[model samples]
Target: MTVVVTPLSGSEKLRLREVFASVQDSGSLLGYIRTYGFVRFHLRVAIGKCIDSRSVSKLESFIMENGLLDRVEGNANVHRWSEQTQLEKGDSIAAGHMSELSGYTRISVTQNNLQELKEIWDQWGNETKQLFYGNYGNLPYLLDVQIDERLFRALAQFWNPAYNCFNFGEVDLVPTIEEYTALLRCPRFQVDRIYSRAVNVPTFWKKLMAITGMSEQWITTRIKEKGECKCISWDALKGLILTHPDETKSVDVFTLSLYGLMVFPRALGYVDEATTDLFHRLSKRVTSVPAILAETFRSLGTCRKAGAGRFVGCAQLLLAWFYSHFRLIDKVVCRVFFEDYSLLKDIIVSTRRVNVPEENWIALLQNLQSKDVEWRAPWMIPGEILYRCGSFDWVPLLGIWGAIGYVPLLVLRQFGLRQFMLATHGLTQSEFAYRGADYKKRVGEISSAWNKTCRLKGVAIGPTTTLEYVEWRGRRVNDNIPEPDVEGARPMEEYLQVMP
Candidate 1:
């Protein structure tokens, strides 16, 4: 007998192929394709994405195709309430209460009661067993489950025996970051901004951990240092500021230094003489002035060698110190290196240029990004002009120095560069590279905003936008864009592009 199987229709085969294609498109479904692909069902996919109007159609189709919806029982009003509800599904006490006592011989009417009890037992008996037995091998669970402490309890009050299975005292659950922050009105979880958030205990603890990078030793040390004054962290630092009221010495010098080394450069309105003083005091406490000076010199030398120029990291620090306390920096620089080196000469030249306006300063920095060592000496020229301008524009420029120059070099040397970059980038877009078209748009926005600010402050600023002297101006006045000869003038695009 020759037996031949009929070929599948073209449309049927196409539909099957389409179903397989959809299944394979889903990564999860494709993972089990070889084993589960043969047992195909349309219900699963339809239910997954179908919602609202779509969901109604899917349900209707399912019911029509399955032919079960018509016969299925609808509502039992399971949410309904009654006083008889005291007889829970599995409560034997309820069954007993409902039973009637007979005067002579009692006839059992247990059919309904047995059925209800069976239903209750069937529903939850396996659940109870599974809960207690599933992970009994786990020591913590086994000790609690295996031991029948209630059976061994001594009698108390009127009872001959007392059962003591449940512990009644309130449990002190560990606080999560959110819980702790909420309690303290501070931010404890991951955040893009900390200044606006309230610092809580958990947030405080986390900050302490991040700053100290210690689980036990550093915390203990801080606690001892802080004494009963406060907890050992930024919160403690703030608390000290609140409590001491007089002594500047107790102000968290370490925190100030870390803040100096970490945050200020990337954020605007955060740099100030007060914060700088705090940083200075902190650094002096942690590292001697002479040591700091030495490191600064060393860093300057390294940058000089790297062809990145001298006034990058440590040099900037040195300059910052000088700016902070001119008399002090002058006194120290003259006392230490005046006789041997032209370091004082260079500093004096740089100091003379400190009065330059912020826009001019930023322009100078943009110029410095490309120029060689020879072009850097002229940097002091812009600084002198700025100083002459008596521009307190120095404040924002300090942030640029800290974020772009000092912080990058500092973290890179320590190799914790990623976190350093993350913190800086989170503070401001300017701190990170937003290259290409995004960068152009950002620079343009910044330029316009800055011009508006300068105008509002009544500060005299040269035009930021240029009017090209093109032949297309056929209507009236054809004037060329006026260009101001700032110390280091570059093309607008060149001036705006951030250095990598």
Candidate 2:
């Protein structure tokens, strides 16, 4: 079972040159070598450090001049000889299963260089950690790397759920003018070291608007017209922003992440006037954090661009609406509007991507929670949110709706009229006795009215079932209100003006 191996010949130089020519980026470098038959690059220890332009050209000419190309032709030990040839060409020497160093003297300098490389790596690692950039590399390299999921999670936050966007992460941090100049001067290869820590950071929406110099209004009109509420992903917004001339400013990843958190949801039309007002107040509060303000503006600009003008107005119009409308807890509404956003930090921490990073799912859940909190903040949930937001003119109706716990219950009756009731207990099929007489009392009155109407209209009798009170918008009508025309729902202002 002995295996005989062929050796490489100098004739393979052409093939090696072709393979090297195919190497594009770092990833391609490995792939090319593996696919292109036992190809490898070797450099003299002294010349390796200086193998650029002049030196490489000199070696190429030297190889071609020698009959080295013919010497490698179909030899039994060619592979072994070729391996040795490759080693001899570089600082390291190798043949068959053995390898030796051609330049042992450079070991001290190499050790020193190794220390310097470690220092640079450490510096980049610290900086990346500070910016909360995610670890990115091939599986083998990154598998052993300690990936702080916290950092990955934070980086994921900048993604806008509506738009399927991603933050640029560490990739945006290109070499500065000074860094580039140093790279050009430094002989020891530093390119790999510099780019190793690079990850993509998201571009904020405002940054995009700034570059395009598109007015906030134009964006809003288009977005609304497109009917794409929250459809613009943060990544798309970033790309668009970079294409603009005026707005192409470099921003840190953390700042952009914060910006996304504050603005992306708003852009998606998840915000109400009160929520908008809250953001405005938050804007004033985080003035020291100008990136926050920048993010807010960009988000608004994106929404405007996305055609969410209604939302942009909602953010600014809430305060005015508060002044004009006399509601009981105007102060409370103001308080809830300005509620602390710190809770989002906890939610962010708890959020997880099942397998792949899912930005939108986490965002929707967060938006739902935030809205629920905003609605409940005013009343302390000592009562109900829907009941309070309704602000119905009739106190008894509010009491009735509130007592029902806002859950719709359906019940079939022996009588001809269908009966529906609000239940504290949300719909359940478990057999249970009806203890409270009040619900039946309420049910009786509704049945009587329904029966009276049916008799007057001469309608058929059957086992009437409750469709659920949540659907009962008619109870919302009273002395101050007429039967809804069903033509079209009136605008908020007209509807409000018709009431007290």
Candidate 3:
């Protein structure tokens, strides 16, 4: 005999709810599962209904045996009302103009001349390139990424500042620290030695002197003020990369320029003072992943809330991360997975440079479904997740330019674990810059909080969520599930209309 589990009809749903209630009252659901072999049926019927805690273990075993875990984990219902409310609150807090942002603001990306950097890199030998890669990973590949302005604009619209992930239709996707670290492939990054703002930071010229071994006179003369911060022109950096006596110093200057122009380009054609501070710390073996992610989230949140602004974060890296999740490239063969391979290089080569219309991209993202998202990036195989701050609730990240917070518990499904409604009460409160009166105190507090980060080890088998977690997700107001837009037309109608 064969068994097929289908969606329950209205009457069937009512009957299943009553059955579950009676089983909970009698505490015989575990006995029922073992005797009747109705495990799959009951699991399917338990989507929004509460399951008896007594039967959870048996149900988990059955789910694992039948390979039905993904289906059960992915069946979360979309809660539209909660998503909208959260978005509004986040926007109000960030920009104070939520009512005016009905349509997305046109995004302005940094126009850095990476073609010049790539040309300079192309002149280096394999040994020289390897030396550079040893410190910075495959950062040079970012030069190959032709910025897709329209796609990024559309992509920016879906960024939910409330949760720090892209909420497209019914899907939730965020670029995690682990994913960025792997993509960087830099051997120098130590996960535990993260970057945080110090109470007393060194001057930009002094930091530059330490990095380049240049005289204080040389560094101070070259530094120019750009807006509120100081910067060194690319011409000065280029001269050092080409004519500097020491090969190591030349490489260091080149890497610094890359971080400024490519990764965190606050000012075009120059490396910012903040970039120098971060690069100085990088020399001390500090992990750049969290700082990179923090700036990325901060910039996206700023742009999203204002409904428009120039994106000051790394566009190439963001686009690369975006393409990895949405595009269907060739599958990775077994050998490549075990051997040395560059996932960022693959993404840059595979992604086409065609410019899709901004409206079309927006329409497509707005209509995204669970089936459309590749939850886990193929390159990501995390052994564990940095889920909490020491003993605090969620992790807080401090960037060179600003700060923000994210809840790793909210995104467990991205790591192939089950999703749940995690507590996020104080996350938004942590979002601020280094300029406020209490900014120093806030940074000090967050920096201390990082000392006690708690990690959850990856599980090989069994359900990732508890009975209480599943129940909470089912009953929670602000759920992660995607729902129809306010207009209530067919979900794909707008998408199709905007497509070529």
Candidate 4:
């Protein structure tokens, strides 16, 4: 679905700020609360809950599923807590009283208490599952099944138990030139100016995963290398990738190189002195940076070993990435490549003739989203995530207000029920995309109060709009509205009038 930015009015900003803060305080926003304000502890807890003998077991399976886990040893896990403690859901046991019940019962192991400790899932009892589901407003019950799926779509990338800390989910894409153009062009300035939601986002780094079709290993490895450092120098980053020259290194190479180019002026603010200087020095040698970006992806596509029509996979990855931004990014992941390409009018990169069938592209889209990923609620909660005082194994379901239970999802925690709303299309229109099962009418009511009350841009995000590639002129074009140039750009519907 195409992402459209629904601007919020100034008074609406105040309302949203209040709503966001209040929600954060409420246990209802378990994901946001866990991720923000002393998040290291929470992330550590999330990782700790995931990274264990079970994680080790999972890693072995992943290595079999993927390639080797890693050649080098990853960072050591030194932060210690009692592995044998039983953490209750929401309720707490006194520190002094902890030792008294240790022998009686405790959630000693990870969430492997109910079933075999093979995977990350914890079994949920119907009654307890219903109770916790009600706590989060019964997300699926409250919203359409699509909303639940959309809410949790891209989370597996960030919260896999295998990699532990916020990580990337492997997209398993085949790569495309047009897709790369859309990616490098994702308007950072407009998104930053308009959408005031996520920090350290707005940059195209997250979106780059779609462009290069890189693996998550590359991302995690880069995370280890980059650490708290947000920006990277082309020389160091490109040098590291080129030097490694392994197939796997493509992940780090493709993701970081493009990110460095897109966020150029802001580079100095986030990176070290050496990193900033490298970009400045390199830009002198390069007349057209965008050309370099286009060429890079073209080369990536050619190198990929797909039988034929490799660009189809690349295009699909880009579309999937673009559609996901609707659920992931707070605003439209505007197809800024046209605008970005305009900035480099002097440089040009020619793409191969487009001959892939439309069905192939459509099929890839289905493949990326074909599977359903589900999780049990509150098991991801810190109450259960953190080690508590008694109870081998976490509970699968509540056992008379017991300690162990099933796991909840990070994606659902952050996006579902606890929605960050924008304005409706018109003064009277209510955007129904975020409307859950019971909340349809209320969204419009809230929007009306927005303008009468105060204004943050005062724009409205409409419902899910489809962004498919229609053959424009000769090249395959992907955008909400199609325009050859970023100036006076509009959706591609008019251009398709010429098509059959």
Candidate 5:
């Protein structure tokens, strides 16, 4: 199916003509938009609704005439077409190998365990629950979320690791920091104070001691090293939640366990030491949104690259975020807009769509269009974007387990801003596991980068994109290697295919 482009209105065309006449250097228009803000409404007009094909062709021709397109920088002596041919060949071969593999593996997240955690939380005294609510803001509600593993498995197949988003035909969607922060709704979290990997890391027991106000000896006894990570089992934490003498200390321990098991579950039943380090920082008001987003992106990319693997990230929160965008239900009540109302709770309870077969889900997503997506969730009021880090060109995100780069510039439309074709030079190279020889060096670099983040204040206008950005996106889609066809297989055989 072909993408439908939206034609510009006569008024919009007139406005564009005026802007074009005012520009002293046509080539500098891109720079001008980058420096001083452009009114998003006056620019491309709307997202999903793009400039018509005729207008796009005319715009490109006009740009060429005005020498606005940047010249390619490379050795003129090189065989450029031959180089392109070689890259295409490599991509085709890799895609072929990937297609031969089985479908997406089921995620390993323990929903039953989360439900058990919720049952325990329900049994807590009103005072204990109030303490958690005051600080965490409806986080306990996430335990009640029922994750659709089949839906997530199908969603995983559409992840484009190179671009760091889910590429559903013409629609590109990703969970933004603003959306997650709102969903988390933790009153204690300071958005400006982000978490980063410290150069001198503390031991798991030391961090736990600080959080729980427990003796070092006690913490040391419970700490168990599991597969290169130091973790404390849920059973140990559950015991404290029920038996601890100090109410505040017990709540703190329960909250920490929630972060390990629900927010950033690296293991099945244990809270990893890395999670403890991040949790410790939270006491000082550091926001966990970026770290949460980083792990989600990292896990998705890992699963996509391998074609089949157990997703280790937080499945419930991811599914909640997904539902917020592709709303299957009707408009939630006006109460959802109130400060006291828990949107997460409503989503968890209201999301009762029947299980969709994996292949059907894949087909539905593959045919997704911009018109089909709710670009911004209903509960989200657009906020300033963390576009660049320090003097770094792109934003760098630090996760508990690793670091990866984010191109907020590419996703400007998510914040009701005009999207443009900003150069994504080193994004793919920025992802790295936290256990390399230069792990410390990499962590330090990302930490320093976060310290220098640049936030673009959000404008109150509709989302739109430039013609240049649309053209660039089209090129990316064209260049992408096609997945192998899944045709001619018998229905029974398709249904019986193993998820792994």
Candidate 6:
């Protein structure tokens, strides 16, 4: 069938010309609405950044030139390719793929109630099939890149089962002006690498407030509200922890993950004080990391079909939380927190019975051997994390949960030729990793890294090397690393040797 294009009618043409005139005259909706000079100027930067005159013209032209305004063809002609091709294509291609992706990424909800939710989560780390962000892309790209299970297990190499939401609150670095601006600036604001990093906050209070208001509105509305439980109720989640240590529903986990994504960044000073305090209080009430893992392990027998997405996603939160909250050992901290040193030691190293698979159990133990913090400093590389979790004597550096008023602890990881020589009677690349290069620059850079928002690298390497921990006075801190002893602590090689 041949389709005849309708020309813009006189009246329709006049109306469109008028709308276009207004759109260009103001350069924004707020402007087109005819706000006062003060308000217009305040929103000018935001308006310019957000408004796409070219796209708006395309939209207007589509309605007039295609007879969409008159509904000549109604919804039938709407889907056809035209000047606004991307709009229709996005509806089918982007939106359709997103929904399909959501289905694939959703946790296989085995049971509706908390009991089955708990079981599925316990049997696996999470109740869902969505283990990683990339899982959505997995099904579509399966022919090209086979999803690897070992890639998921890498985090196991660094998990400390002892440290979850139970006693931990997500601590994140404050976003620097540049990082904050990078997040806030409109996508069209092209940054010249040479001078872009220098983008500073507005000097005037009104301007700053306006910018912040825009940011808050933008951040708040970006994610759609599920209208379900915003977070696991403190009492309900806590009960699950005491009565059901090793299981959790994916919904609760995902809710808390979203909650953290919004709250923790603001806590780092991205938002108002009231907002920060409210989120901090909420953080205290949610489930702990250890508790989540416990429930996950307990349910492993049943949720065999579950995906790794939720587990990996939430677990990364803990890693980033641990690093962002890292504290150097101070005199007062050593005296007050470690006063009951023996009690602390027993809690971590005491022998206990666990029902997890041998390999997984050992991997969790290895994760505790070193905290694989999500954030990294400038001078740091993976190997330079000095050995704080010495196979024999070192204590695993546990994280301090802000909600519980726990103190962040750091410990010295000092080992020389004698220790290195005894370990293998040979030199290794690990020996000189932490040293060399400009130390001051490293400290500055690491400090700078901490000021950025949370970025988690959930991979675990079992050397108790902390990427960054420094005092406000700029002194390097050495708090004791949390090195708890698991019953079957042995070399990774030993575990592998007996594996196959």
Clash numbers, per candidate: 15, 30, 5, 36, 1, 46
Candidate 5 structure quality by residue, lDDT tens digits, 1-500: 66454554444443444334333332343543442223233345422234445545444444455333331111111123223433443221232323332345444444327765777788898888888877777778778667776678778877766667777657677887877887888888888788987878887777888888878888889889899888899988888888889988888888888888988877778999999999888878888888988898998888666666667777778887777666433344322234565778775556545456767566666666566666656566533467677655667788988988776666665655556565455566778988869978887877777777766643322226656567767655322323423463233223323444
Tens-digit lDDT track for model 1 on 98-189?
Answer: 21211112111111112222232234344442432221111111111111111111000001000000111110011111111211121122
Q: In candidate 2, what are the lDDT values of residues 1-500, reduced to their tens digit?
A: 54333332342333333333233322322343343322223333212233344443444454355322332222213223323432344211112322121111110000001222223224444444333222211111111122222223322333221111221211001111111111112222222111110022122234324433456664453332214222233443344333444321222221232223222233332221222222222212211111222222233223323323222211111121112111221122221111212111221121222232223222322222111212112211110001111111100111111111111111111111123332211111111112355554543333233222110001112323223322332231121111223344332222222112
lDDT of each: 0.24, 0.24, 0.68, 0.24, 0.66, 0.24
lDDT comparing candidate 2 with the true structure: 0.24
- Candidate with top TM-score is 3
Writing each residue's lDDT as its tens digit, candidate 3 over 195-236 gives: 888778988888999989999999989999999999999999
Could you give candidate 4's per-residue lDDT for residues 419-498 as a string of tens digits? Answer: 12111111111112222474434433332332231101111122111121011112211111111233433332222122
Candidate 5 collision pairs: 390-452
- Cα error, residue 56 of model 1, in Å, equals 99
Question: Which model scores highest in lDDT?
Answer: 3
lDDT of 6 by residue, 1-500 (tens): 54344454443343333233222222334333443343334333323323234434433454445332222122122212111332322211121221111111122212112233333334544224334221111111111111223322332332211111111111212112122121122222222211101123222222322322324443343322223212222233223333533222233333232323322221211222222222232222321222222223222211222322333122222222222223210111111112112211221121222232445433433333222222332112111112112221111111111110000111112110000111111111111111247433433332243233221111122333332221210221111111334564554333333222
Model 6 TM-score is 0.20
Task: Look at candidate 2 and tell me the lDDT of residue 175.
Answer: 12
lDDT for position 457 in model 4:
13
Clashes of 1: 15
lDDT comparing candidate 6 with the true structure: 0.24
Q: Flag the better candidate by TM-score, 3 or 6.
A: 3
What is the Å distance of residue 96 in model 3 from its true position?
Answer: 17
* Number of clashing residue pairs, candidate 5: 1
Q: After superposition, how far is residue 291 of candidate 2 from its true place, in Å?
A: 25
